[model samples]
Target chain A: MYVESTGIQVIETIEELQKTLNRNERKDTTVGFVPTMGFLHEGHLSLVSHAKEQNDIVVMSIFVNPAQFGPGEDFESYPRDREKDLRLASEAGVDIVFIPSVEEMYPADGGIRILPGRQADELCGASRPGHFDGVLKVVLKLFNIVDPDRSYFGMKDAQQLAIIETFVRDFNLRTAIVRVPIVREEDGLAKSSRNVNLTAIERSEAPAIYQALQSGVEMFADGANPEAVERQVAEGIIANSSGKIDYVKILAYPELGPVTDDTEEIILACAVKFSSTRLIDNIIMSTKDGTPCSE
Target chain B: MYVESTGIQVIETIEELQKTLNRNERKDTTVGFVPTMGFLHEGHLSLVSHAKEQNDIVVMSIFVNPAQFGPGEDFESYPRDREKDLRLASEAGVDIVFIPSVEEMYPADGGIRILPGRQADELCGASRPGHFDGVLKVVLKLFNIVDPDRSYFGMKDAQQLAIIETFVRDFNLRTAIVRVPIVREEDGLAKSSRNVNLTAIERSEAPAIYQALQSGVEMFADGANPEAVERQVAEGIIANSSGKIDYVKILAYPELGPVTDDTEEIILACAVKFSSTRLIDNIIMSTKDGTPCSE
Candidate 1:
């Protein structure tokens, strides 16, 4: 899969990636990074676009990290297609695509992992124990290796983006984190690689996850209490969709803490399992002052 | 007592230090870092000299990290003399000295920490649980903020140095770890800030700790059984000193694992309690192949 003239360098080893990044670093070129667990979708491509526009060189890493996956969590069957990813990433203006095998990222024994503090105890963390901490460890590793001036993450995974942002602040890492808005299908379904696993009918029902989030966002914007917003979303997903509801939560934006009188910019989010495919979506709305309104 | 005209920059925050470093980084200057707990002594000064010799710029941080201290350990009473440290650091050719408050290094609530792998289970770890992991967390934080080309650590804490080197390799940090030889007092006691806390009798008896280490090194050089070597060192320290011995371990150099027939270099390490103060020291001697003889 040769890209005509994109100059996309697809390297598979950490040493080669460091050499590539170092060369750009020596020339005083600012590098931007987009990290992904592959199977390219529009959501990831949007982050790639943001990265390319922000820096002189853009690097995208495609590794289905094993640490983030639990024992029964589809690690063995996670979808991977390097040929398609290569062509799409090249066309998306990624200067370097780092595709490392899991063995390269983690040794036979799992290396050291992060014990994420209080922030990881709520919402999604309850359902998937050690998930976000696993994510933080790998992202921290990538940030150290890539040494990017800026790194992009799609807000499609609001919890993930929030946790990683906290990790950066807590560690005082040099890279700047840029949060991009989620990209959705015309039917309002958020783009996800897991969507491919859904049956046609289940896929049709997946839009309800976003619809529930949208409903909660509207209710919150109308000055409804957080409890009411959460109830409305939860009931809406369970009642209107054929998919099994996982969770519908309403909370403070990046902090993911409880919403109170002091809270501003609430995030209403939900997840649904449609024919064994679990998907999540969220919407952020202002409550009072927009402290971080850059997005 | 300031140096006549040495341009030593003492930064108190991560932001200011980063800004200072970025300017030098842009000029392609190689940065060497030495991280220390305050009350600068010959041991820490040795690390700083090695750092200065290896790079265009030398950065030393004097942070009496509270995390590395377990409850009942010396976090509150850790000796600190900033004025003396400043003069000594400036004399050592340090370009920058970063002294961050615990609040600045660790946010209001101490944030994410690393869960160190197997190597953290033995040695000092058995005496002070979660000690090396705490050291790892702070060092990882320092490496991120410093962004140095090479970092220096004294071999006095052989276990700590080994674990940090493993961390650098495991996480693929850009900084190269350079181990400096342990600096000893004229009486042959390993120099440590904790030495100041000892009573006159304890101070006088401290030389026996190093004497035991030297004895162990001599035994290993003669290819003595590692178990017999450990016994000799423990009994020597106990019989020769008024201090209560904590541990005497002769293990594979950097791995800190059990010694085997193929072991290349051996670390003869000990920790002893002199009244209320704890002192640690070690010596590395070449084995069959001498993998750790780089120093």
Candidate 2:
């Protein structure tokens, strides 16, 4: 049922969500879904906005998926603000907000799992083993529950978006994937829920992560090879910020394969650790013209 | 497109099947799906019959999934009488038949896969590792393509049935799984596509496999423990037939857990090998009433 004040229908169980969607289904409504982990930011809201424009109905799911987090990761300390999220979602024109609990999502040991292949062995997946498998598992379950006409994802977590796209294509999922470009702060820090965890000093240094990616993109535009682009991005991050470098990779887009002369599209991506917060950002570009593909 | 002679819509691609099902969707049609490897027998048609009774549309998929077949198994040698199968499918009142080639199903190395947990460790899965993982993967893909309201499976592959049911429940799949009782020969042998591979002597001996299972069911009815029921079934197969016993055991029905007094339902299941041909059979019964649960 919808809360009168918010005018956004809130569904907490899979059954209830399906029932509500089924009612909409009779009218030939096309649904667009945006799945998030509850601590909503501009990046997530951007996805909802895209969904609203393309779909007759927009659904936003707020589930802090435990399966995707590793042992030392901040699953416990992850930021959450339900009231603020609902307010922002309503303003963003989201029609339904599904807030399922942990127990509700994982009622028992699912004895079945979705495992990612080689695309998961580098970048965030390398640092966080079993992360994409968990991500795919939850996303598949969410997709089955929502059965949306289209699902929106941001390119800030570029590798995650690629792997999810791969899953949908390989599995013959009905929902089309809509790629939403990375939404950034005015200074170019990719907006993330984890940005709230940064100290004031760390906050000022975080925009350097995206700045370094832009440098790499510029290097490639100037005819620099992948190795030089990766090195320049790595060096730029080190010189500009106190954050430790995690990785600066320029790989074939979506496939995440080693870039070669034949590669048409590539991604210059990086991750940085600043005391408590770890940030990731990337630029997907056409290798031919060396222009940003999605911006 | 439908072949005029058969009057059954035969689709070979996922896209066309979805498009056809989409047309059915607008009419509030409920679909029932039956997925099988080709060479349809009475057992497969029985599934279609159950599906016909339940839904407005029936989609049967025949894919000899390479993933579910282990090395040295009967995959390459597996029977395929497509012309006969189409005749039977049309005769059985099937609305649509989906026959996808291996390349169509796996266009590329699907880096993503569905892995089964402890439930797959015993019975057929023990000897055939990575088997149910393939089964679940293909089934999930087909379920996605068909988007059926209900799907049908036979209890002859009782362990596979249990695993599929578990997967559907754990993943919150919209498709409801309907368990059709195993169709068997009048002589008590379970009907299977592989039954044709049996030698004359082996074919004669195959009935003993089901007889042994029925004996075990009687033992359980007489208050025998799981061990006694298992041993009795094993000895019966060895005494009555020359076939080598693969496995004979009684376990809790769907979870495949060890049988305990608290277990309400149990399956007395067995497998046998005669030269190259292998056979499996099972009887699911209520512990309290000692009667077959479905049949």
Candidate 3:
């Protein structure tokens, strides 16, 4: 199913993707999937690389899902580089690169939707209503289409990763969710597709988001309570970044519940808005062992 | 994966069911699934028989989905005869019978749900709000668990069939939806588990619901408009039974839209409540050629 020129299969239709995957599945080939919005960065390629190592075949889907974007969001202006993305995907060892059009993905009105529960109420979902619902919708569709053995998601979008994990577990889906470490730049800013939208000044200030999360992680390690850790993180972002703080808090890891004495894992997370760009970063830490669990 | 005595494998947990199916699936065995609430009547057995005919292995699931039942909607008093259901399933050629406990299916607060669209609004959904949402939720979970090549659904619950079809199509699910025609009693009453709940007099009168749908089919065959067909069906139900009419509708099939000159297929459907028992029956018809497409 490879394109002769690139040696990477580029599938544009669901029928063809299903046909190719069906043939591979019959041969007991395990598929690892990485879903993205078509702007391949180091973060996305890291997921692809992780996928390639774990399974016989790697499938990367590049769909700029409109459902996840709210009004006034950057859906229309969202960056896309198909040519560069394919080259990066091929280099990353993707066996199949699924590039479905909006029409190809959603040929009809999607009467059926996956609604998130309390897990979607805070963080990014707080600012953007119905955002997690849209994410779950597209992910479920792609899961059904690809039928991958394992699906890879980066922890950079920690909340999105958490919500997706909850969905797969609750739905009893066969695909195992694999969490990859977030890819970051040398200056310690998390790699993101939206980073291109940042102005030079905003770009310089953006690293503060991760720095604040690290500060929160240190406070938690020093036996700070959840409230203290939250306040320190918020103050750090205010002190260094031109971006307005959207939210800064520490909560139980995947559950996103209130941190209590029994809670072992916690997430130090924050979102900051710089002019027209919004940036989010988080550090998952083990509260009991005093160690950072994820970047 | 068979229970030696009965020659039918009965799986109680998701893990065991997945193990059995995975083994079979690796051998390229096609699975045909029939999902039921477990008080098996002729209609349900018919679905099992259809599944048996279509695939190398037939899997039947029997669990009364609590999500689909509303408050005060007979969830507690729902009929169950597991021994009899097992026997019927075995006799009907079911290879694997999955009977998961409520706790197994819903171990935690299901923070995710499948919300259905407008196709749910007019029929049973109008009376039972959020009913189709519950239906879609359970159906999607079952589909994920089974991963069948084809799933059999009886057309007796016409709207349920339509909504399931829409969910599969919109979600781009791999399971092919196989529509089995309605199974009826000698008296032409549609066979249902709930029929046993009806009083003797009510049971005698219940056949009128199907008869009314037949009358509506004749009207449509005589070139009756949608409104006229709806009226005739309602009048026939009122004239023949001591029951209250819930709704009688003639809508474009599958889409459940308004029937116009451009419309080719339509559903003539009705619901009648006889004291404690409520019954629904429908006839899918082709308006363009003037014929009943389904019982």
In terms of lDDT, which candidate is strongest? 2
Model 1's alpha-carbon lDDT is 0.82
Count of backbone clashes, every candidate in sequence: 1, 0, 0
User: Comparing 1 and 2 by lDDT, which wins?
Assistant: 2
lDDT of 3 by residue, B141-217 (tens): 88889889899999888889988998888888879999999999999999989888899988888888888888788
Q: Between 1 and 3, whose DockQ is larger?
A: 3
Best by TM-score: 2
Report the TM-score measured on chain A for model 1.
Answer: 0.93
Interface RMSD of 1: 2.8
Candidate 1 chain A lowest-lDDT run of ten: A286-295
Error of 1 at B74 (Å): 1.1
**What's the residue-level lDDT of A89 in candidate 3?**
90
If you superpose only chain B onto the true chain B, what TM-score does each candidate give?
0.94, 0.97, 0.96
The DockQ assigned to candidate 1 is: 0.55
Docking class of 3: medium
Ranking by TM-score: 2, 3, 1
Q: Each model's DockQ?
A: 0.55, 0.65, 0.65
Candidate 3 at residue B170, lDDT?
Answer: 82
Lowest lDDT block of 10, candidate 3 chain B: B19-28
